[model samples]
Target: MPALNIDFSDEELAELRETAKARGVTLKSLVREAVTEDLAQRRALAAMTAVLRAFTAEHTTAFDDAFPDDAPTGARRRGAA
Candidate 1:
């Protein structure tokens, strides 16, 4: 596994230390878990974006027709149709 180096402010470091202590884990373990969770979250977001892009690309024409061309010119609710 690769090692990561990160920098935090004094107050942030103090908070991390307190949080780790409260969780009964070492500072290093807490940092590792945070980094792992962040990376997983980023990957999940990337996957979702890719899927949305692919879906739109595949259905551009039909998706466009799903709405009416005479939509309220600006952002206004015309009337209760």
Candidate 2:
């Protein structure tokens, strides 16, 4: 596999090294895990946004009509008055 080089300030590098040592992991492993998790979170958010947009496009009018101006205010459980 290819390798990548990153530059960090002395303070930042020291902090990362300290955190990795405290976790009993190498700095590379710690950084790799963080990057992986961030990418996954971003992908999940994008997917959720797409689904919401599609649902809104398909149901905007129906959703609006279901809650007309005189809709009741308080909360109610299923099959409740």
Candidate 3:
């Protein structure tokens, strides 16, 4: 129930208004939907990043063993350096 005030260039406002009208939504509704979708995408990205980090931490040695040539010079299994 809080109000947010955002300023847009005249051209940007015109484009947003036109797009909202074409989609049969009020400008406020259009902006709200866009914000919701953006937040969802950001949350998904954060989760994906965490999963990837965990995978790398757990599998780095396995990967290095599987492809020994990919390992750093004389350094394999995470501490052969």
Best candidate (score: lDDT) = 3
Alpha carbon deviation, residue 11, candidate 1 (Å): 1.4
lDDT of 1 by residue, 17-69 (tens): 99999999999999989988999999999999999978866765464456657
- Model 1's TM-score against the true structure: 0.73
* Least well predicted 10-residue stretch by lDDT in candidate 3: 72-81
Clashes of each: 0, 0, 0
Better of 2 and 3 by lDDT: 3
> Which of the numbered candidates is closest to the native, going by highest TM-score?
3
Q: How many backbone clashes does candidate 1 have?
A: 0
lDDT against the true structure, per candidate, is: 0.80, 0.80, 0.89
Model 2 compared with the native: what TM-score?
Answer: 0.76
Query: Which residue ranges in model 3 land beyond 4 Å of their true spot?
Result: 73-81
Put the candidates in lDDT order, highest first.
3, 2, 1
Residue-by-residue lDDT tens digits, candidate 2, 6-62: 999999999999999999999999999998999999999999999997886676556
Predicted candidate 3 versus true structure: per-residue lDDT over 40-78, tens digit per residue: 999999999999988987888888889888776654457
Ranking by TM-score: 3, 2, 1
